[model samples]
Target: MKKSIIVSTLILSSSLTFAFDLSAIAKNVVENVTKEQTTTQETSTSNLSDTTVSNGLKEALKTGVNYAVTQLGSNNGYLNNTAVKIPLPDNLAKAETLIRSIGGDKMADNLINSMNTAASKAAPKTAEVFVEAIDKMTLTDAQAILSGGNDAATNYFKANTSDSLKKLITPIIQETMKENQVASYYDTANNLYKSNVKGLVDNSGVMGLAKNFGVDSFIPGSSDESLDEYITTKAIDGLFTMIGQKEAAIRANPLEQTSSILKEVFGK
Candidate 1:
């Protein structure tokens, strides 16, 4: 009897110890599972928030760019628009008159039309490139652009899109100039330049024929590269200038009858 009781006690003690170990293991497993779930939830939330902020920035930029391009592409977008209208360059007036007087009136008019058309056509595309840049913006950048001046956003667009804009506008300008028979106008211009230089040389006894043809250097500190560069650059600048104007207006007073999405996005 004593031996059997001792054997029973040992069996009970072993069972209790085994049960305690299983309970401890189950508690640890439950705790680990809960921690993993919490971490996954936090990570998903963070990623979603980042995506929202990024997309928001892109939308704002797209809106601004579209508004600007639309204004510029419209009739008299550059010529009538006060914010970015390109004025006639003084040096080209005499050249234009000489060409017109020399029976190149049609060619000169075509050249003007070509320049204007190119400006209008190329103005709208700037927004497309700017929208791409906006995608790269962070939340902080979006906030900064929104709060910045009318030209601040435009300046930013220029900063990002200048190289691409040049690549695009240069070809378009070249094409327009050719299609409008710019070569004919240039010939007239060259003749006028030569005549003027010849008269000046006759009076002053100084040879400037090379300078007239751009074969020799001009007077010291008299560079015209900036003037030529402005032809296209001004058009691009005007495009963004109009956009910045519209953007500012939208931000300040907003539209009365905006689209549902616009209301949803900008109404806030």
Candidate 2:
């Protein structure tokens, strides 16, 4: 009877010890898990601090702006690029058609070429404006742009620099157009049409002839858009479009991360 009691006591003691060990193990496991979670959270928060985010966004914008300027500020940049090619304005379309139909196609072509040339000449000036605008970007703006969609940076620049860009680009365009004699060509064409052609064609008779020939009729002095204004507006729009493309490329391609900050922020 004493042996049985002693054996029972040992067995009960062993059971209590085992239960205590299991409780301690469970407590250790919970503590370890909590620590790991806290460390991970801290690391994530540290990685995306305000300065990092802001700098990363600014770097991306600078890359985009520089790439766009390099691509568009070269010879034949606007003339060869169909996407941003400055065609005759809509108001001048009829004038171009008229000139073309009368074997003055070279003159019309010259006008179009001059417009594109002026835009190309004015493109280099944009880099200065873009850099200035980028320098003025606030941290809040950077955060908003980084969290926004692919074109967010481009949109931000457009919104902030539109007025400044217009003011900066307009005079350059005007100077280039003047050098190219864009206004002179248009005025010459208008004067020629008015002096030599208008008296020869009866308006109703010409309309009838145009209807019979299934060709759109033409008129001169109808275009309200000034050449300088049209070229300046189109040039700025094209630059923005190019910048947007660059921004998207950087956002989507890890290889485009040119700097350490970009690699850290956008590499994800």
TM-score winner? 2
- Candidate 2 deviant stretches above 4 angstroms: 1-46, 94-98, 187-213, 217-221
The local lDDT score (0 to 100) that residue 207 gets in candidate 1 is 43
Shift in Å, residue 202, candidate 2? 11
Cα-based lDDT for every prediction = 0.63, 0.80
Error of 2 at 45 (Å): 7.5
TM-score of each: 0.57, 0.72
Superposed Cα deviation of residue 11, candidate 1 (Å): 99
Over the stretch 30-107, how does candidate 2's per-residue lDDT look in tens digits? 999999999986787576878887888788888888887888888888888878888887757766867787897877
User: What lDDT is reached at residue 245 by model 1?
Assistant: 66
User: How much lDDT does candidate 1 score?
Assistant: 0.63
lDDT of 2: 0.80
Clash counts for all predictions = 1, 0
